[model samples]
Target: MDMGIEINTRFGRLGINTTDALIDIKSRMPVVEARSKPPRVRIDTQHVQVSIDQKQCFAEVGLKPADVFAKEMAQKSRSKGLKAIADIARKGDTLARVDKNPNAIPALAKGVMGKRLDYTVAALPRSRPRVSFSGGVDINWDMGYVQLRAATSRPEITATRAGVDVYILQKAAVDIKYTRDGFDTTI
Candidate 1:
């Protein structure tokens, strides 16, 4: 099934033409051209409708970050988990030394709370504002959720026609048409 699995919950569909990838890259995407618009990232598209004013970079699943992390860590040996934790700590220390920012982790971790994981606005016409690194910070013990490997699309799409296959994944889609009409239900 071609479900809503595109990245950033896209605002428009990206039609992959028969042309070369470079040629397609040269062609600019249709922009909404609105001032103070929401963030938009162009991932490979599918048959899904996206509304404007969307937020967040990734969809928040029924699975919690803590739970997922624990499960993943559990799959590995105790020594592996310890090593991973050590690696994270080393990276943190490196950042602290280089940037001279004591509160680096605390400040950099304001990205992982919402279902949407991206936002964009014309900060300046000449200046291209971009957020390269964003993630959730450790609330208590300074843990971070990195490396997303969530399954997108269904198994049926990948299944062969000769045999019958069953997929037990949720039909997930992010509502892109976010509005600030808290009180007005005049739609």
Candidate 2:
């Protein structure tokens, strides 16, 4: 006449405090049936941190040719203004056929060549000397200081029931350190 049963929730803490059972005098109840324990191997370890920063400076500027075109009068597409007056009337009389006005010289070559040409930079391209100084002064303040480290070790499960090899889960050894700050600047 012996029986035991004790279970705690949250998927843990279970103690039947077994004394082995066998009591069934026709149906007194105690045939033994209490086995619920197979879930215990929780290991979690993870830590990661990273930081990177790189700043560079160097410049030279001088550009001047501000014609940025715009003479207006650019209207060509009556089949290219009649194919440029039919190639200047087959190369012999187009000033609008000597001024009879077939739209006079393609309206003066679409007013001297179809306008709209831009280049406005005759005085604003000046940054030729900042010489590195954004955490790398003159080029070596940890030239873009970068550090990366990672660790995730704890996963080596080995188990054998009868061939003489109990159980083992040991694998934790991974440490890394890297740093590069300054002197390799190419902008």
Candidate 3:
């Protein structure tokens, strides 16, 4: 007696799906600003001034005596004897005298005869005129300055991860057959 057996098999298959990663980035640059101011200046000035005084000079020139005779007469008027004689003559002598003799010597009186005679003498002034002068100047200044400002922003980024999916499309299978004396026995 002879026995035989035969078998058939089929393998399973799988399917897969994949996805790629993605990234996005955004950036911003820094900014700067500056400002400046100019300096300021100011100036002040006063003009020169002058003043002159000539009152004393003019009075000295106008009141000076003309000659030595007038100066001597002015000095004799202040003597005590001359002043007493003048007083006595004014009080007692009122008659006029006539000179009939030609041989009488001329009399010289040592005194001022004028009723209006100035005795006070003015002092002489300096050769140069009196002068005064004044002047001034002032200056002011202000310093300059500068201002600066700066700003910056952070960067932004976005990202995505990769992913994969798998699934079975078919399952494994097997078939068996037996034969006895060349005749099929099992199916």
Clashes of each: 9, 7, 0
Model 3 segments more than 4 A misplaced: 1-4, 38-146, 177-187
Top-TM-score structure, candidate number: 3
Model 1 TM-score on a 0 to 1 scale:
0.15
- Tens digits of per-residue lDDT for model 1, 96-162: 6855766666644642243565887642234233344333333323233344343343222232234
Over 48-112, each residue of candidate 2 has an lDDT whose tens digit, in order, gives 33333211111123222233122122332456788888876664655537657677656667766
**Top-scoring candidate (lDDT):** 3
Better of 2 and 3 by TM-score: 3
TM-scores, all models, native as reference: 0.15, 0.15, 0.34
If the candidates were sorted by their TM-score against the true structure, best first, what order would they fall in?
Answer: 3, 2, 1
Ranked by TM-score, the better of candidates 1 and 3 is: 3
Which 10-residue window in model 1 sums to the lowest lDDT?
53-62
> What shift in Å separates residue 95 of candidate 1 from its native position after superposition?
5.3
RMSD of each: 60.4, 45.9, 12.4
Residue pairs in candidate 1 whose N, alpha carbon or C atoms collide under 3 angstroms: 39-119, 39-120, 55-116, 56-116, 56-117, 56-118, 57-116, 57-117, 57-118
Task: State the lDDT at 35 in candidate 1.
Answer: 34
By summed lDDT, the worst window of 10 consecutive residues in model 3 runs over: 102-111
| lDDT of predicted model 2 | 0.42
